[model samples]
Target: MHLPEIRRSHIAIAVISGLLFSLSFRLNQYFDALFVYSAGISLLFLPAGVKLLAVLVGRLPAIVGIMVVSVHLGASIWPDKPMTAIVYFAFVSLMTYPIATLGVMRLFHIRKNLSNLRYHHIVVLSVVASILNGLVHNWLYLAQGVTTSEELWHKSAAMALGDFMGCFVVVAFFHAAMGVLRSARNPQID
Candidate 1:
């Protein structure tokens, strides 16, 4: 059985991935949710360069950094309790990765660390993770005594979509670039 090696280069890409995600930041006043996102619908619907769960896990530090900055951007959503917002956001980001990773493993029968995932597998994981992201964020809103169900739904959907889109866009770009480089070196290869 082949095991996945933890490449420093990949890990570095992970860190940089967070930066790319950060570049996706934008505000949607309707939901009062400030978030970073990429218009990656084109790639999100398709199977792109979705990395393995273990590899993504290795990028936890960078992911956490991105989460901190992202949450801070929306601190005004809970101006009176900014700390509460930060803590909850951080907690969700930390907890989601492990739980979702387990979900991916069970759902896809992937026991190997950092093994390549199938396209459908990646899509399934993306949807599940998005729901988890939305649920946690929405739960926080409810806990804070917000009662507008419609707005709650909107916020959750926006946040989930933003994250998903950003990731998808980044993956698509990376794969496309690699393909271009590979094709350049081999004229016969397509």
Candidate 2:
């Protein structure tokens, strides 16, 4: 595709991904009693998976969408938080996927296109991403006095578990969908 076409497609992808992220966030809120673990953590944060998938497929531009939605949602989610804290968490959310992707890619020597990616790779990435995300975000929250040191580890674990479950669910569904597509494209005669 030409530069303009590529840009348009990337923009479209980012918008769609952002919408999906927003929807997931709303759904998580709807089931807040079941999914939420703390002020900023969910027991099943589907947006974490959406963020990962967007970066995996859409590259850097995906961050734009995720960041925008994150900031917007962060304000409403934690209205008492200062704008700086909201922005800070938004950035942390944006950084999570790229950091995880780069680390996983470098460690595994996986290709950028992820053509050689496997379920194990995804699992590893999810774990690394979730841990890093939970730690960094909670650390920042602690620094900002949003969370107490006593609650740090518990909050971090909650966040990590939520992110991991979200990533797992999304990746599993994507894998199954791809399998169905592949089978449809090359069906066997009985």
Q: Write the per-residue lDDT of candidate 2 for residues 9-51, one digit (tens) a residue.
A: 8888878888888998887777678888888789898888877
lDDT digits (tens) for residues 71-102 of candidate 1: 66547445677686667765665466457757
Cα lDDT of candidate 1 equals: 0.51
- Candidate 2 lDDT (Cα, 0 to 1): 0.84
> What is the Cα-based TM-score of model 2?
0.91
lDDT of each: 0.51, 0.84
lDDT score, candidate 1, position 41: 19
Please list the residue runs of candidate 1 whose C-alpha ends up more than 4 Å from where it truly belongs after superposition. 1-18, 27-58, 109-115, 147-169, 172-190
- Pick the lDDT winner: 2
Each model's TM-score? 0.57, 0.91
